[model samples]
Target: MTERRPRKDAVRNRMAVLAAADALFNRRESPEDLTMADIAAAAGVGKATLFRAFGDRTGLLRALYEARLEPTMDAVKAGPPPLGPTTPPLARIPALLDALLCFKLDNRRLALALEGTAGAGPYRAANYERWHSLLKVMLEQIPGMADSDFIAHALLAATRADLVEHLAGQERVPPERMRTQLAAFTARVLGTRPTPGSNAED
Candidate 1:
């Protein structure tokens, strides 16, 4: 049989389904609990159409994570003063943590999901490797900083959302408190002393 062309309404319905799923998963604390029917009802589409748009629940979740993670990434990259590209890496390093801290507050679940996937598959390998390389470049700016590679690994480990979640949830530390120390500590690792009482809010 010949391939059937999707009707205009069908295309619109699929986009609606994915959009609804993205919103629900990103906004909720327990995104993993979302079901296809829940997504369809929210989208005003039939369950079959939801599945057709996304092959499985995982695909839907992935779609949602991608849509929402941009703000988190963008925040760290450009939303604020020191974190934005206009600032030197020395300032951006600590500011990245502050900007990312706000992102963690807004999109913690999606942020955790990205962090969880950072080292498993080939795609993740490429992303992780790229970030590692970027940190290595940042380290080059610091005179005589030992073992840039090792330090990069340590810095990444310290700043991850999973670690933050543990600190915030299990350790009962407030997110703001953890972010304060995390940003200050990250700057120290980069071989720069944070200026006393210097404001670095993103």
Candidate 2:
């Protein structure tokens, strides 16, 4: 005997739930606090239907976060200058940092979630690695930077969620000071030897 397939209503309901979750999480920076009932309400379906569609919060967050972050880095890796290819190696490092700081400020929770290798599993790890790879490639293009890839990995580590939270959230450092420090630190690691031109000392 043949198995029965989901009806069109089931399919539409599933898509709507995913869409609602993605909008809430990605656009508004909502966390896994979103519930099946919330998704069902947003999707105009019942709670049981959302469970049947997404299984659990982890499953939905994983799928939706992957869908968002993977393409995000892709655009960063390919779009125009300052973010993508075609920017000068020296300028690109600081530019990337600026973009990243904005991203962190906007998606602070999701960025925090990616820090631990657990829970996120292999897929999130792969996304982190992708960000590292793009950064390393930009570094490698710089002249005399022999250990650019290794240096890029180090830069990535330095910009992690723990440090960002401590410095910005707890210490309450001013945004300009933070930007100057990050650019200086990143530039130093990449061996760019910053000029003493109007930046915070140390």
Candidate 3:
């Protein structure tokens, strides 16, 4: 059966809601405080429209997060070495971790808001599972790697949105430094030497 496309106004409303949500998240320090009404008002749409389009707060967050993640996800799926499928697992794993860390850092507020929702814990989140499954596959490819599943989880834990927020917000860690630390940690886990000039300590 052929699927019917959304009406022009529905598409426009979705885009407007996404844009307004993005702006609100970027502008606010605590995105968790942002309500559906706030985003509806900002987008000049009715609250009913927001709920009808997104179903609930969690659905809206997932949509917005996925929209923001599209470019990075594209690069990871088919772009050149380090993230692309063509790269060696040994190299690609770290690159993937680095990319995830950067993404969390860049979208800290949105990440925190989404991750903090009830029933949306990191372990069960669809996006988290996707990355974990990909990382586990890569880890299995590397020679002599053990417990790829647990390793994938451990590696991803380092870049959790809550941890990122704590490090980048409360601790005020520099972005470069966090990247360096993550790279060094990933290297250690993969049983490889750390990159030049990178160690466990600052």
Clashes in model 3: which pairs? none
For candidate 2, write residues 1-202 as lDDT tens digits.
Answer: 8999989988778778878876666655446465667767877888787777767665565555565655446656697876677778787777776667656655556556555433543324545677678778887787777786677777776667666766777898776777778778876676665434528355
Ordered list by TM-score, greatest first: 3, 1, 2
- Tens digits of per-residue lDDT, candidate 3, 56-171, equal 99899999999989988998899998689999998888888888899999999888878877365677665998999999999999888999999999999999999999999999
The local lDDT score (0 to 100) that residue 48 gets in candidate 3 is 100
For model 2, the stretches where C-alpha displacement exceeds 4 angstroms are 1-15, 22-32, 46-56, 62-75, 114-124, 193-202
Residue 51 in candidate 3 has what lDDT? 99
Q: Model 2, 125: alpha-carbon shift in Å? A: 3.1
Q: CA lDDT of each candidate?
A: 0.67, 0.67, 0.89
Full-model lDDT, candidate 3: 0.89
Question: CA shift at 40, candidate 2, in angstroms?
Answer: 3.5
TM-score of 2: 0.68
Among these predictions, the greatest TM-score belongs to 3
Between candidates 2 and 3, name the one with more favorable TM-score.
Answer: 3
lDDT of 2: 0.67
